[model samples]
Target chain A: MARIVGSIMSTHVPSIAGAMSRHAEGEPYWKPFFDGYEPVRAWLDEVRPDVAVVVHNDHGLNFFLDKMPTFAVGCAPQYLHADEGWGIPEVEPFPGDPQLSWHLVESLIGEEFDLTTCQEMLVDHAVTNPMQLCWPDPDDRAAIRIVPVTVNTVMFPYPSARRCYALGEAIGRAITSYDAEEDLKVVLMGTGGLSHQLEGRRAGFINKEFDLRFLESLTEEPAWATQYSGEDLVRLTGSQGVELLMWLTARAALLGGARKVTSNYHIPISNTAAGTVVLEPAA
Target chain B: MGTGTTRHEIPGTTIFDGAEAQKGYALNKMCFSFNDGTNRAAFLDDEEAYCHRYGLSDDQTKAIRDRDVLRLLELGGHPYYLAKFAGIFRLDVQDLGALQTGLSKEEFQARLVAAGR
Candidate 1:
């Protein structure tokens, strides 16, 4: 049986990738950011998760205005970089684990998750940016396979935070039921969030205090976190509140109580809080 | 290869037809906010400025000068501006990528087809 080794919730700001990709070990802009994740890196090295299930929202990529599913899963062998208006940056293609992904998909659907599966898809910064932060490597692309899950946050009438948390629980059930012989240590990652508005006149708003409180509530009282519907979240934190659905992943991982390994918060990464948290299952 | 005489042929009809254009426009309008007065004004002003600056063909200039919503939508991909147009046209939210609640694609498609596409 497969078991979730840990979970992570990180902000998906594109600039974080830009910072890490360009700076050295102790450079001014990059030092604090990389240093913050040292403990997380050590934890991951110890746990050695076999697979990572990343929950992220596509930013006008793949599912454009044509059709955006509430939740889509990638079962492809590889994922290309999604072009966001301006073409894709010079980045390595993401390798996917088709077998594991399909198994999880079949299991989830059997468990009644209603997931949409894709063979070929493009992933934008929402998925890759935080990934670079968590698993920073140039050549070790195939070290761990990924199951990419997308949420609908671009348009209105998005899923409620509670619904997202429920989805997480379903994922937990599916992972445990998979018929695999190998010892599978799964990592559920929720990427995007920590209050920052983007769009219209309120493009540059940043609430560090709100971000910290939200992070605290995520680990301590996840149920309280889900009370805010998508609409309420938007009203309180502008349109970007849609990213709160990423917390569902954390909620899912915390089904049996997660031991907090590391947490860090930084400000003003192109008008957003660059925050990250790593949690492992309690011993 | 040596140069050879070649006949240039243009098809009488194309995929970019009236219905497709209309569908594209509807999709864009449904998805964006182009119906707002400010956005409409900016669009009109921009069209005029583009026509004047580029010295484009009469047909091209007319496409912009006339404010043909369908033509404009066909030219530019569906964006936020289309939502405003959707509001103005009163497009059905279902037609604008709202997947049916608690239903699979096959189930939703069957219902849609039964209701007449």
Candidate 2:
């Protein structure tokens, strides 16, 4: 059986990669955002999980409008990175855990969640940025394997909060039930959100009040957000702010009450109200 | 299950719904192609011919030519895909936000910083 380490929810803003490429974390403009990750990095060092199950949304790197899957799970042996239109430099490919991936795919489908399985998936910044944020050193990043579970946030008719939460629950069950002979420690990650829209006249929209409350709800009332529809979330948060759905799904995967170990909320990280939270399930 | 009948309007924002997706297929498909460097270079070489090859609507072609962020959005462009189009000119989200809001880049950035306070 696999042991759950905890869950980490982060905002996967692409500009972070640009700043990182320039080695600008110490610069005044980026210091505050960069400092927030120190505690998380320390925690990761302590837990030292062997595998990370990343729950994120793709921003037009892998799947285009031609055929969008509502929920897709990567079962590949390795995942590569590509140019995401912007000039952000691509990172090294991340190793994957195919054995665990197949078990998850089997368990999730048995639990009645039909998911599109990908043998080869190209992850965009949404997946890479968080990895870099956690493991800034290239060697540290390469040590752990990854399993990407992407939900559709690129298009409308996204999976409802309830559905995303349920998916998280199934993920928790599947991870715990894996019949591994060796002991395994797995970390779950939810990437993106904290409210900021980047389209239409409301291009610079940010709802701090809503973002703060939503962050609080993650620990106190994990299912609090499930009450709202996708439209409601977009209205309250912002078009892109709705990426908070990824956070909810990751938080729900904890499967029980959890205490917020640490959280950082900052504004204007490249058109986003950037936020990150680490939750440890109640004992 | 069919919640499309009831539309929720968020002022100053456009939801990329099924209808919007249908309308922007050609334009978005063209934008998606920009993921490849060659396609981006080709689009820059001859903008009009590129638009024709993508089967873009006259309005969409004009929107591309004018680099009108708001108009392209009105024509059903997804911000994510339009972002690829914006990259041809090296414009990031802040630039797009400034363009759509009719504000200078500095003003838009300040507004975002102020949101935290």
TM-score of every model? 0.70, 0.98
Q: Candidate 1 lDDT, tens digit per residue, A1-283?
A: 7888878888776556656656654776456666777887788879888888889888655665556688889999888773343222446788887887888788778867788899988887788876677678755545777889898876555767887888888888778777778988888888887665533223334555566677787666666667876655665554564576886665575576767788987654444556778877667
Which predicted model would earn the best lDDT? 2
iRMS, all models: 18.9, 0.8
Which runs of model 2 end up more than 4 angstroms from their true locations? B1-4
> Which lDDT value does model 1 have at A38?
82
Cα lDDT tens digits, model 2, B1-65, are 23356786789998888888889999999999999999999999999999999999999999999
DockQ of structure 2: 0.85
Error of 2 at B36 (Å): 0.7
Judged by DockQ, which candidate is best? 2
Candidate 2 chain A: worst 10 consecutive residues by lDDT?
A259-268
- Model 2, residue B71: C-alpha shift (Å): 0.8
DockQ of each: 0.02, 0.85
